[model samples]
Target chain A: MRGNRIRGHGLAGYIVLSVFAVPTLFPIYVMLNMAGKDLFQYTLRPLLPTFPYHFENYLYAWQFLARSFFNNLVIIGVSTTIVLLLASMTAYALARHSFPGKRFVFYAILCVLAIPATVIMVPQFMLVVQLGVVNTLFAVMLPYAAHQSLVIIVLYTSFSQLNESMFEAARIDGAGHLRIFTTIVIPLSKPILAAMAIFEVWWLWNDYAWPSLVLSSARLRTVALQLVTFVDGMAIPQPGQEMAANVIAALPIVLLFLFSMKTFISGITSGAVKL
Target chain B: MMDKPQVLAGHRSARRMRDVRIYLLMLPSLVLISLFFYYPAVSGFIYSFTRVTTRGAVWAGLANYQRLLADTRLIASFGNLAQIVVFNVIVVATMPLMAAVLMFRMRNPRAQYAFRLMYVFPMVVPMVVMIIIWRWIYSLDGGLNILLSLVGLESITRAWLGDRQLVLYAIMFVNFPWMGGLNFLIYLSGLQSISEELFDAAIVDGVGPVSRFFLIELPLIRDQIRLLVLLTVIFWLQRFELPLILTDGGPGWASMVPGLRMYHSISRDFNIGYGSAIGTVLFILVFGMTMLQMRLGRRRAAADNR
Candidate 1:
């Protein structure tokens, strides 16, 4: 009787999960299938394979998008590194030290979180233009780095929950503030930091609107911006090629999620609850 | 006596030096926020009060706000956003709550893990890529149409995004998959935190599963629900990528929301002041909703504590 009950539950779970999973993943599968087919085959049947496989379309998309994969890497790499360093240091000070106006500063950061990026995009663009950094990687990286103080505030809140005695002990061992932060506070807060890093990486990698406004040069276009090329002049690229580009664009994040699913889930939940 | 006074002066200097170092540590983030965040936000507000031309901004005092009030297109854009916000509240609130309850009922460990992971997969993919993939699915002879045909519903398959009436709702449906992830996880966490002893007590009172959910679980998860609703409203108002890529506010601006409308006014028309006014309205709407949500969340949290 118990065995039967267990089997029934398992079956129900599988059915429910698959129903949800198919919609989530179906687009990627369709894209892959479409990208592999030629234009003639794609438009003729619309469903079902007429060809084995071909990758020539990816090359065309790569050139059309213009420095896409490389540009995206530079943007992500530079922005993520800057965000991590600045957020960590700021978070360390806020979490560990007590200063006048600290509460005011923290609340200010929280306020910015509620203001959508769209609200600031126009003025931010004008600011970037006046600085003569338009169409450059710096325009993308600077705003992203500046906008990341919220990550620091969130991290600091979690880090503050740690015992202060640990810091005192480090100080007793002749460690200075910088030494204590790097050796003690940072290592102990790894879980929260990891969570913040992955979350921000995903955010920066997939961001579209800011990049669209600040970056118009073909050579500096990020992957998300490059995906826009598929609909050039309102002519949709072959379904297969469009799908292929999406698959490539989505691949890194998917892999990251699969590997760190636990942290990603926990991090988001923790952050939300704290807020 | 001279040596002791000198030592006391040295201690005072060291303390001042430490305080300065702390301020230096905070300097970068403070400056960055002032320059990049608060500066633009304040200037954005100021620009809304002017007339921006090819040369520069000229004082237009209330003209931009007047234009926003009189503009039919902007009004329609807000109406469209209201529809999305309504739909988002329903989808984001109810669907995930149901999924979370079902997830709680399942006893098998591996099944639970798999279900949780599957739900969150959509959250990992960038919104841009997700929209692109959906565009393919919504193509006339694409996956969705093919599926409709296979199910003997060929007449139902129109260009999902092409029809003026159906375009907004179709775009909403594309965002539906994301509903499963964050909301489900939050609800799950809330459920797990409820004490098992309370469930046992309810069972002893002869309460069934449905009543237990209503009498026990609903009250417990009220805070999470309120937060989720607030988040839904903000996200719906701010949503730009999906509509931008999918419909591009097509079929005579039928699907245009405030975000897209603001983008269009600036990028297409270069009417910066007008665009800033629209943006200001959007900011106010979002800010008001957030404040309302925070107030409700706080009240519920207080009540729950009591």
Candidate 2:
């Protein structure tokens, strides 16, 4: 009797959850369904898939977005590396030591959270212009690397939570700060560091506002900038091709999630919670 | 004995050297942040008080601030923002919290896990792609209209994004159900953190699902609710991406937002001073809200201790 009651509750829960899932997953369904359709098929059946899927939409999208894909790779690669190196080294120092001016250093980075990027965007653009890097990839890369405050805060908490006795043992065996950081700290903190890396890549990959301001040059445009202008750049402006490009743009993060699902989910949850 | 004092001084010097190395480790981050963050923040404030043109910046006193007072487009933008913020903070945010509580109470662990994965999978898609799909959905001859006509609601089907009265709500409706992102994960984790004993005790008392949620889960996740609401407010306050990309604040400035206006000032009009003033006002509002949240958190913390 008790088991039956519990089963009844489960059924209700399943029904409610499925109702919510429909709208959430609807767009993904639409994207896939329409991605292979021609204009004629799309008009005839806008809500469902038609016969004879046109796989060439993927081919055309790949050709259209090939260069922008490479550009995103280079920019995200360089910037994510810069953020990880700078933030981890700094986080290590702050977490392991208790030196003078420590509080000042911590607050200086923490306080950046209060100042939204939207506020300083204009002057930051002027600064880029003043430095004579207006049309260069550095215009986006430098600012993105500077977005290290959240990573630093997250790493600091994880680093401080490490077993202090392990560090002491390393020091006694003649391991210096750099050696300890590389061998002991880095290895143990892989999950957290991976999480932070994924977070950085996710945001930088998806960011359009800052890149749109600086990267007007066609060759330097990030995937996001290219995706927004994807239809415009095409010769014929096929709806199928546009949806195909959306799928292509979304592929990298999806692959990353599939491989590291645990880390990816935990990263987003904790990172935003800390903010 | 004299050599012991000398050795102590040597140890102190080595410690001092390590501290200096710590400073060196921090130098790259400090330099980059100063160049990109601190320097522009200070300059953005200074520019708000001046008139900036192609030639140079000049002192304009309170002129920019005064112009902000009379700018009707700016006022309308804020009005639109208020509607967006209210809908998101109150209505949109609740669904995730409710879903999370139901999942937390479930008897089947495997079913719970599957539902969680389904919600989180869409997050892998770049937000821009989602927005593009939504833009297409709201187009005149789009899927929404097609579906409406199929169901015999053809009279109500029209251009969702192009209509002034419905444009803002359409933008809000992009992620209908709003259960696909960080908010859901945050709430689920908050629910997970609650003690198991409280749930068991509620079950023993034969409390219904509704009563258990109201008395136990809702009050326990107060912190998460507060955080998500503040995040939603701050996000809606500054984000013009939807309007900027979807409509470009168009159909005759129906969806114009301050952030989009600021972008236009710099990119299109070259009116840097006015943009900076808008930025300053937004900064004050964001900073003030953040401070209010901190104060409330402290007060609640103190009361809990008492």
Candidate lDDT scores, in order, read 0.76, 0.84
Question: B185-291 in candidate 2: lDDT tens per residue?
Answer: 88888888777777677777887767777888789888879888888887777777888788888888888888888888888888888999999888888777776
Q: Note the DockQ of each predicted structure.
A: 0.44, 0.54
RMSD per candidate (Å) reads: 3.8, 3.0
Please write out the lDDT profile of model 2 over residues A93-176, one tens digit for every residue: 899888789999999998887778777888998899888888788898989999898899889999999998888777777677
Worst 10 contiguous positions by lDDT, candidate 1 chain B: B1-10
For candidate 1, report its TM-score: 0.91
**Lowest-sum lDDT 10-residue window in model 1 chain A:** A1-10
